[model samples]
Target: MSDARAQAPETEIVDRNLTLEIARITERAAIAAAGWRGKGDEMRADQAAVEAMHDALTRIDFKGKVVIGEMRGSEKLGLDEEVGTGRGPDIDVAVDPLEGVTGCAKDLPDALSVLAFAERGGLLHVPDAYMEKIAIGPGYPEGIVDLDKSPRENIETLAKAKGVPITEIVACVLDRPRHASLLAELREIGVAVKLLPDGDIAAVIHAANSDDTGIDIYMGSGGAPEGVLAAVAMRCIGGQMQGRLILDTAAKREQAERIGIPDLKAKYSAEDMAHGDVLFAATGVTKGSLLNGVKILPRKIVTSSVVMRSWSKTTRWITAEHQR
Candidate 1:
């Protein structure tokens, strides 16, 4: 099995704050996507975000390779595509231009624009596939949870580790049909399950930011690219996560093999997904837990964003008022 942790990033660059620049990118995307909110067009909203994010990224000076991006179908920012103006450090980029298309279209909560920056090979490049993920916030003993464990066991163990009852723990999960049995198991164990309509990346962040949200863990399957993006945030915000690609089909397995992931069943740690110096930025497209969505005013637009840097363990909440 190939480990992505080996090619970790070096010390931070002194030139500029990359996290803030990336925040602008997400801000642009969120603003663009917000224009279509509640218009009931998912693809149009996604396209608006993708185009704006691509334009913002290309205008930047860094040399970036899209390690994790919109898979096969999207017109821009596909895997392995080179971006930026090619004038600065060589880095890996992972992005989800619009995280919750459905939510955004319906004017629901937590629609976001997100991306991560890491050193070359600092991110695990996986094919477009579903990933089985398990995550928890910081301050826990290593190896306390595993993907192979049932929800009951994981929740009970986490509750005990925290010296609390199972009812006190809250686990976030996608409200999908596939999770029916898992939901039943969690309910039987008395752990509250927070059902998310979309945005598993936010779900992971919620789990990582347990002090504020009380989300003890996040489990279930989501996009492999989003898994990498979430892992980057964990590196900065402090968390533990594990993911395994669900390459059940022959085509998916072959694609994984082609991308150097020979061990189809190999479980990857958060560090394995993003091991080096990294930055993560996210801007809300709709009002949600982590941030307030873009607000359009008569004379300006306001955006709320969170930017994090791994080396310094700094997390900043930025609010920008752009003249209209």
Candidate 2:
């Protein structure tokens, strides 16, 4: 099989040992966000995480460029911000200092601090826009669920592929007004649906680990940056996914073009979004299915994080305690 990523220079590979460093960065971001959780202030919580992550990034050895980070106009981790000592291998990075801002602000579940590192030109440069996404765990035939297919068709196809009844297959979607019709169609098909208030990145990870998470599929629209991050994780963790940016407005289209995205209507596969070897790390700001929330103890803070490496096909869960 041909990989689109081969076109990019693959001469230098980011050292696999840096996975722990990446986990530390996310842990710092998560612990920082945890302080503001339930404070009912989204911006402050996100900014705190960004600052903490940025500070942690400076302590690392490798040079990194943010391909995806921060929302536009925030300057948090804006599209081209460079970090690190600029002494190690140059790499591409995608980060979400705080994924579930609203959830974190309200003390809800599933808020996470996530980041991915890849060899130079390894990850796609996605605009900060909405992306139509569909993903499913491994062990099924390729192309079981497609972004172009209707919800019912996707459900039926997946059911047939899994050799189960339609009602037995589970689907996860983001909860939003725009999904009103999508929700209706899924219910109309008699399939089980799990609606997440925020953090579709976790939902996508759950889908990729169906045997354990019990989420057979993930479908819906989410941030393009998170979509690319999820695709990078899927590369390391194992899954199939497809995404297409929702370039609805002129500003979005222009931004996409400015970022060298020539085909506005192109559908990107997991490998297309993040190709070759990559490492992904994510820490839980609030407890959820994927990881435990940051725990503030008497004189220390405990954090849980998961780091994955594509080259080795291994996942590492790290827990650290930091003194106050």
Candidate 3:
């Protein structure tokens, strides 16, 4: 692991302050996400998360910008935001408020509020298009698996490389109607499938941190905002992931071009997607997947997050006490 404490002066100053700021924002989001736990309303849960993040960003002492954020007025909720339109460090912000609303509603595990911050033009502002994604834990060769291969083939290949059996490998997919066929296919291959109601960021992080979650792979199309945030975590954890935009229509294609994405089929690696030093923080909203959810008491709320720095390859587990 790189010594995050020993970076150059300029890098150190920016990274340290950014990490602290992200930690605070994520902590607030955790409390907000918890309020919607078991409410059975995903939208309200997500709104609460976004509101907390908005409040936190406004208070931070930085000239930040929202390169990617909750869609809100846009058709999509987490993509399609104008750059430099929101408050805070002239920096880009990517967030998934209440990443797994269904999980929170059902009290499932691994739901979190995920966010990534970078200097302007650092994070990819991918269009609200499907992305063919494949990822693995650290130390695997690049390009080992592409989206074109069969799910079984990819799983077996990854398992072989990791020296694990196919049966032992666990894959995560969004528990959606669109994934019905994909889920059935994995079942036939004897690979264990961990279907999540929401929160691909938690799934991706689980794949990246194999030791903690035992999720060997993450395959499926999820929110573009979550993908960008996962890219930041992958960079810090030395994992490998590739994503290609899946445009459903010409309007979406035009949006891609508007954001300077020349090739829709181009593959984005962790470094390619998160192009510079980044500060990432994710607070658990419910008791599932990666981290535990917030616990509210009479006088205070307890929140947890996994904050990471790409430049330093440092990941910190933070717990904060907030007054009610």
lDDT of each candidate versus the true structure = 0.90, 0.89, 0.78
- Winner by TM-score: 1
Query: Which run of 10 residues does model 2 get worst, by summed lDDT?
Result: 8-17
In candidate 2, stretches whose alpha carbon ends up further than 4 angstroms from where it belongs are 1-16
Tens digits of lDDT, candidate 1, 122-141: 99989989999999999999
Query: How would you encode candidate 2's per-residue C-alpha lDDT over 1-324 as one tens digit per residue?
Result: 246554644444444358778999999999999999999999999999999998998877878898887883566578889988887888888989999999999998899999999988998987779999999988888887888889989999989988999999888999999988988988988888988889988989999999988889998899999999999889988889999999999999999999999899999999999987898999999998899999999999999999998876789988899998
Per-residue lDDT, model 3, residue 58, is 66
- Can you rank all candidates by TM-score, best first? 1, 2, 3
C-alpha RMSD by candidate, in order:
4.1, 3.3, 3.0
Clashes of each: 0, 0, 12
Poorest stretch of ten by lDDT in candidate 1: 1-10
- Candidate 1 regions off by >4 Å? 1-14
**What is the C-alpha RMSD, rounded to one decimal, of candidate 3?**
3.0
Model 3 lDDT tens row, 86-202 = 444467778776677778777778778877888777898787666777888887887777777888889888989988788898998888898888889898889899888777777
Best by lDDT: 1
In candidate 3, stretches whose alpha carbon ends up further than 4 angstroms from where it belongs are 1-9, 12-16, 74-89
Instruction: Score candidate 2 by lDDT.
Output: 0.89
